[model samples]
Target: MTTDASQSQAHTSAKHLYQRHQSVLPDWLAVYYADPIELTHGEGRHVWDAEGNKYLDFFGGILTTMTAHALPEVTKAVSEQAGRIIHSSTLYLNRPMVDLAERIAKLSGIPDARVFFTTSGTEANDTALLLATAYRRSNQILAMRNSYHGRSFSAVGITGNKGWSPTSLSPLQTLYVHGGVRTRGPYAELDDTAFIAACVADLEDLLGHVRSPAALIAEPIQGVGGFTAPPDGLYAAFREVLQERGILWIADEVQTGWGRTGDNFWGWQAHGQNGPPDILTFAKGIGNGMSIGGVVARAEIMNCLDSNSISTFGGTQITMAAGLANLTYLLEHDLQGNARRVGGLLIERLRAIAAQLPGVREVRGRGLMIGIELVKPGTDEADPDGAAAVLEAAREEGLLIGKGGGHNTSVLRLAPPLSLTVAEAEEGAAILERALRSTQF
Candidate 1:
C-alpha cells in the first residue's frame, strides 16, 4: 500500500544492508528474531530504521515507553538529573526516590504501602517471593495458571510455563487455574463477575486441602498469556482470600501498570476504583525503557523488614528522575485516556475484520494492549506452523510484531504505547491480514 518512492527506497536499502553487512544475530535473541530493519531513532509513536524509513511502532518497546518516544520533558529531566547525580550508594537519601515513593503511594490506595526499588521486574518479583516466604514462613506459592512473573529461580518456579528454557524447570510450587471459569467450545469469556467469584471459590477449596500458602501472584492482564484481562471482581476476591488467610496478594504489574490499561495508574484499578494489592511490583514503563523496577508494598509487610534491612541501589537519583518525569507526562497529558480511546477503536476495527477473515479467532484486552489469535482453516486451538508463517511474513513486510502465548500456542500481541493512533492501528491490522492471506496456512 505504500506508493511513495522514497519509502520504498529506504526499506530496500535497509534490507540489502542487513543482508550484505550485518552479522548474524546472537542466538539468545534468536528466540525473537527482530525485523531486518534495524532502528536508529524514534519520535512520538513512530521509529526510523538505519536507512531513514519510518514505521509506526505499535509495540512501544514491549510497553515500556508509555508516554511516547523522545519526550522533551522526560529527556530534559534525565539530562538534568544525570548531570547532577548519576549513581549513589543507598547509604544516603535521594530527592527523586522520596518523591517517586510519595507519588506511587498516593496513586496506590494502600495508605502505608512502602516502595522498594529494583533494577528489573524480575528482581521485584523475586524479592516479593522472598518477602512472602519470610512473612508467612510457608513454602508453597499459589500462582495463577498462564501467569508470567519473571525469569528468576523463585519466579520461574512459580511460572506455569514448563519449557520456557531448558533449565526453567523447578520444584513445582505453582498451580494453574483454568484460564476462564466458564467453558466454551474453543475459547470463552469470563462470565461477568462470576469468574472471579469462581476462582476464589476454587482457591478456598484448594486451600482446604493444602497445608499452607505463602503468596498468590498474578498479572492484571496475562500479558504473555494472550493478554487475557483477569475477570471482574478478581482482585477483590484475591484480596479477601489473602487477607483472611494472612497470605500475600502480589500483583505483578510489570506489564500492566503505569496506566497502560487506562482509567488508573495500575492494573488493579481495572477491578474497581481503589483496589490495591498487598505487594505490587512494577518495572516496565517506570523508566520509559530504562531498566528500573520496584515494589509498592503495604506497610504491614514493610514493617516486618528490619529498619536497617531493605536497602539497595534500586532507587538512585537518575533512574528515579527519569521515572518521575515519565509518570508526570503520562498523568498530565492524560495518556491513559488516550490508550482507552484509541485501544477501544482498534478493538472494534479488528473485531469487524475478524468477523470475515479465516483463521481470525479472538480479539481481547484493554487500552493499547491487544491480542489477535490466528488459527488454522478450522481448529479449536492454534496451528503453530500457520502462526509462524504469519509472523515470518509480517517481518518480511517491514513491520515488527510479537507472539505472546505461553505454550507456543500462537497469538499476535499488540502492546503499542498509549499514543498509538487509529490510522496506525488499521495499517498494522491490514499488514497482518496481508501476511495471513499470503502465507500457505
Candidate 2:
C-alpha cells in the first residue's frame, strides 16, 4: 500500500503517523532538534530538500564541509576505502587509521602526535578534556566563557553557557576565562599590541588564584561565539600563561581547523606566533557527511593517559578510511588556497552587505567561517533580531545559514564548503542580500 495520501485529510493522518515515531524520542534528544527544510541531497555548493526546495549552501554545515558537498575526490576516496575494507576494530591496526594519523600529525606541526579518534566533534573534545585532566593530574580546566567546546556532559560542564547559569556543574571542575565583549569589541581599531595587552590582562585576572589546572581549552577562533578571532599575539600570550602554570593548552579546532581559516592548514597555524597547542581535537570536515573526529596529543600527554585508557570503536577502519580520503582531498586539491581566495571574496561581500543592511552591524570571521551580527538603528550593536530575521528569510529564499552566539541570536555564521567558488560565493551573497532587503521588522 502506498504511504502517500492524496486527500488533505489522508495526508494529515500520514504525517501524524510519521511524526508518531518521534513521540517515543527522549526529550533531551528532541531539545536540540531545530526543524528545517528536510535536506534530501547535496552536490557542490547546494542541496535540495525532500519537498524539492533547492538551497545555496553558504555555511558548509557550520564549516564542516571543508571540501564542499559530494565532491568527486572525497566521494571517490570514501568509496574506494569502503570497497577495500570498512570497519575493522581499532585494535587490529588498519592501514587507514595509521596513515591518516601520520598525515594529520605532520600537518599539525606538533611533535610526536598520537591519535584517539571519536565519532563526533563532541566525543573528540571529550577525549581532549579527559587527556588534559589525566596528563596534568589536576581536576580543573579553564576554557573561555562564551566559548563552545562541545555538548556532552564533560564538554557541556565546561561550556560556560548552560553551566554558568542557575546551578553549578561542580563535579567537572571546569573554570572559565572571559575572552572579550562577546559581541562588539570597541577594541576593533585599537593597535594589536593594545588588544593583546588587554586580553592578557583579562586572562591573568581569570587565572588568578587557581592553583593549577590540567588544560586551557579554547577555539583559536571563537566559531559559535561569532567567529571571534583575537589579535596576533593573543594566543601566544595565553599559551605563555598556561605554560607558566604548567597547564596544557588544548586547541578546540572543531570549527576553525582544517583550512577553514584562509591562512593556515589548521586554525592554530594562523596563530604561528603562538606555536603549537599541546593537544588538538578535530572533527566535522574529516569525513564530510560521515561521522569522524579525533584528538592529537603530544607524546607526553598520550603517555600519561595510556595506563588507564580504554574506548571501544574510537577509531574504526571505516571512519579512518573516510578521514584518510578527506585528508587526501585537502592536500591534493590545494583546497586551502581556495579557502583563502574565495573566503576573502565571501567576507568582502558580507561586509558589503553589512554596508547596505541597516540591521547588519558587523561582518567578521576567518577564512570561509564568516558571521554577520544584526543590529537595528538606535539599538546596541549587540542587538540580534536582525540576524534571526535574516536566517529565517534566507532559508525561505533557498539559502542555508547557521545562527549562534552567547546571549543573542545576533550572529549569522557561514562555514560553507571549501569547495565554494567565487561565483558561487557571489550567488549566495545575492540570496542573503535579498533576504536582508526583504526581511520585516
Clashing residue pairs in candidate 1 (N, C-alpha, C atoms within 3 angstroms) = 58-416
After superposition, the stretches of candidate 1 with alpha carbons farther than 4 Å from their true spots are 1-26, 34-37, 163-172, 179-190, 272-275, 307-312, 396-398
Write one digit per residue (lDDT tens) for candidate 2, span 1-441.
233433444545545644764787654442112333446689888987655557888766667776868877777777887787777666676777788888888887888888877888899988888778887788798877777777777877777555223345645687777553434454555577877777778778877866688888888788677777676557778888777878888888888777878788787765557579999999988887778888998888877855555556767777776677777788788888898899898899878777866677778876788877777665655566667677778887778888776657577888888878888889888888888888742
Give candidate 2's TM-score: 0.90
Off by over 4 Å in 2: 1-18, 26-35, 163-167, 180-191, 306-308, 381-384
Show the lowest summed lDDT stretch of 10 residues, model 2.
28-37
Put down candidate 1 lDDT per residue, 150-259, tens digits, no spaces.
77777778876554433645644665554321233123455655666667777888888886788888887887766776566676766787678787778899998887
